[model samples]
Target chain A: MAIIETADLRKVFRSVKRRPGVGGAIAALFSREYEEKAAVDGITMSLEAGELVGYLGPNGAGKSTTIKMLTGILVPTSGSISVADLVPHRQRLENAQNIGVVFGQRSQLYWDLPLRESFALLRSIYDVPRERFRENLDHFIEILDLDEFMDTPVRQLSLGERMRGDFAAAMLHDPKIVYLDEPTIGLDVVAKEAIREFITQLNRERGTTIILTTHDLADIERLARRVILIDDGTIIFDGPISRLREEYGTHRTLVITLADSYEDVQVEGADLESREGNVVRLRFDRRRTSAEALIRRAMERYALSDIAIVEPDIDSIVRRIYREGYTEGAIGSPS
Target chain B: MSVVFSRPRFRLEPYVEFAKVAMAKEATYRFDVFTNIASVLVRVYILRTVWVALYAHNAAPSELPLHAVITYSTIAMLMSLVMDIDQTRILRDSLHDGSIVLDFTKPMRVPLYFIANGTGEVLFHAVLMIPALALALFFVHIDVPSFGTLAVFLVSFLLGYSVGFCINFILNCTAFWTLEITAVQFIVTWITDLVGGELVPLVLFPAALQNVLVVLPFAAMFSTPLLIYVGHIPPAQYAGALGLQAFWLIALGAVSVVMWRLGARRLVSQGG
Candidate 1:
């Protein structure tokens, strides 16, 4: 059975019409008006058991809204959702036990107590058995390398340290379905790598189904086989990560080591994307012609010593999507 | 009815977990607790000094001895610790920071969580209060409660706690609709504590006012419960106090629960 399913999920929040400044404040003191804003607009998604899907979108693009609905934090204005055979908002407590959440910017750990105390508290909150709690704690502490700071107050820990502690606290209950919103946001390279590694291990070892929303493309590249790209409160694409690359991301750039100086080095079929020192970069879509073909043409024409192909990265793809889809005008596609 | 585990109830697990959270939180803010205890003590001293001068120096009527007034002041001081919720602060914080989203999703009952949170706070305050009372005992000839009086005190104390919790619940739900209504809650808390006897003895009120308070739960929440400890209200009056407390607790709890349901349905957060 599918672990999670939703049918046209939507959430509408009422915006109170408070007047501006002192005049609006006085009027609001006497009377208030409101308008309705649709936060999550008619979203429908389904995930099978044991599938780790990456949910990606810009801030306020309804990623958190969707997750909140899924976690039962906010009930939908319309439509239905079922997770683990229970309606999330209707059966919140049931979902809470089965699903764990980690908001990247927030700490779930008890800030005043030692990390161990927060773990112990969560053990009782989820009612994990004593042996199970100990087992999970040991594994988490070891994997997260928290042995040195297990006794430290959460308030005293570094952001990376605190994030690790939160990771442990969320896992103490041994929940089956995990929801991570930007879990690697604002982290050092080592910290981000550590978190990604832990997430990979948890899904592989424990069969924990994960729904991760991250700004880090490497996270998507590293762990997520499946990707769900959202924009303007709607899913624009949902397919394998590699498939996203294959479909809208086949363009690669050719960097040629110019044997000598050449001014106004422009190509018709291929664009002169960049030039630095003795090297010149030519970009062309693979569908139009392969990177090797472009490099061959450049070499035949210009005195080139060495050449290397650069694959299209997430930054370029997202920029292209935003520039074309979100803004005015479209990009020159495969043409 | 079997109260323990007849079903998969939200039970007291969250309460227990929240207790740890509160304790750990209190440990970090240990200074705040100390300052709070000092503030209560200062209020006690201010009231005690004024009343002592009124009775001992023949400045007031009825000759209610220094010890009697001191006992009244001490009881009011100790009870004040139990009544420091500041509902307005809670409501304002919840509305502003958007952390209320955390608990709104839980399968557990919302009002029950609020009550449990109050209980956690009471547990912490009760610890400091005991030592404060013990210290006051050394400096004053306060009347200690007998076995029967202590029993009445215990029952009435729980009732008082329920009353305070209900009032807080009703007041906090006001935040659902109102903008910046912390002043409203602060006023209500001050009136309840001062008028119902957290500043001085409720008996200091006019005879008519005391009679009116007898029928109200706010008085039962603070004054009536503490009177049993100070040996002012005898154990026999305990039944009447308990009866009044029961009526008010049931009435206020029911009203607050209804308000919570209505308020929650109308809750509109400004988040996407």
Candidate 2:
């Protein structure tokens, strides 16, 4: 069964229309003009237990809005959502007990309290049993290596330490699902890897359903097997990572270095993209010709000293999806 | 995994924990505590001196004795300290920075959590302000109420605290609509100081203004309790004064509840 399900979820914000300058400010008070903006529009998706899905969108693309609705922070204007068998907005407190939320730019821990105290307070808020709280605490502490700075005040801790503390606080109740919004944003590479590894372990061992929204493609690549792409408040793409590659990531580059300078170097089923002295680059569709076949043909035509095949990186694929909308042909394709 | 204890049913445990954490957090700002005490002392001194000078200049004796006015000023300062709600800035900051979304996601009502946290800060200030109150009493002569009146005063003070919290909660709810709450804060503080009898005792006001102000919720927050404290409220009117306080407490509390519900809905819809 799906741990979270949303059908045609939508949220529209109505803002007062204000004119510019002093006269406009005065006019605004007297005149009631409103403009409606749709932050999340007609999004339908579901997440099964232990499934890790990355929700990707550019800035102001409604990624956070959808997460907010799912977590019950914002009520939807239309549609229905069921998280952990509870309607989040209608049963907010009950739903809150079963889900955890983390935001990269925000710290949920009390500013002046030590990390340990914040965790204890969260435990109380969630009503986790004392022993269960301890078990989760010990487990996260050991896994995240929080012993070193657990006693430090949250405001005094470094960004990485604070994020770690926030993660532990969110999970203290052993919530059934966790929503991570840009969890690794603004962290160093090492810190990012640590968080990614922790997320992977959490999903593998605890069956925690995760909905990750991040700008960092590495986070999506390392942690999420499934991807849900949104743009302008609508879901544009939903499929496995491999399908994303197979569809938009069709072009592959093969670079070959010749043992000796050849005036004529030709290969079938591959376009000679560029040539630089003894080195030449060829482009071919992965669907049409294999890298091995291209290389075998290149060897037959010229003396090859070295060869390298470059497939499209996930970052580029995601960027392309954002720049140019994904086609409907990519949906529901097998990995 | 080892066998673990089952999760317990939700209770007031979280609010108590929030209160404890808030108290501990306030304790860290020692310099702020000292500054608050100094400011309160300075304010008391200024008000006392102004009243003494006014009394000296008056050709006719004032209705309230000089001693009684001094006592009102002193106790009003102390009452203000105890009844003050400290979550205004926290609310504004949270809303401005969008952390309020995370706050709403917690397993507690936003108003209750804030009230609990603010109460903790009030408790802390109440303890620390004892010495300051002692110093104020040394400088002014205050008439002690009878045991019955004292009991009435304590009840009035509790109601006053609730009134103040409701007012503060309502004001803070404006954060959902406007990000810059400084103007709202200033207006609220000024009006509260004027109408709540924090700056001038309600007894000194014109008879008509006093009649009107006494029935307002602002009077319940400061003037009602202070009147009971200094024996200014007649024994016959004691029940009426307490009843007025209770009325405002319930009425303002209901208003706060409505405002909170509407404001929370606005917050969610507006994507705060």
- Local distance difference test, each candidate: 0.75, 0.84
User: Per-candidate TM vs. native?
Assistant: 0.88, 0.91
Once superposed on the true structure, which residue ranges of model 2 sit more than 4 Å away at CA? A17-29, A257-280, A296-305, A330-335, B1-10, B60-62, B85-88
Best by DockQ: 2
Which RMSD does model 2 reach against the true structure? Answer: 4.6
Interface RMSD of each: 5.9, 7.9
Model 2: per-residue Cα lDDT at residue A243: 87
Error of 1 at A109 (Å): 0.7
Candidate 1 positional error at B154, Å: 3.6
lDDT of 1 by residue, A243-299 (tens): 777666757788889887888686556877778987888788777777666766777
In model 2, what lDDT does residue B239 have? 83
- On residues B48-82, what C-alpha lDDT tens digit does candidate 1 reach at each position? 77877777667554534567678777777776676
RMSD per prediction, one decimal? 4.0, 4.6
Which of the numbered candidates is closest to the native, going by highest lDDT? 2
lDDT of 2 by residue, B53-98 (tens): 9989885335578877888888888777776655545666788888
Overall local distance difference test of candidate 1: 0.75
How far does residue A329 in candidate 2 sit from its true spot (Å)? 3.7
DockQ of 2: 0.43
Off by over 4 Å in 1: A18-21, A276-278, A326-335, B1-7, B20-46, B56-60, B63-66, B85-96, B104-114, B173-181, B207-216, B226-237, B262-272
**Isolated chain B TM-score per model:** 0.86, 0.90
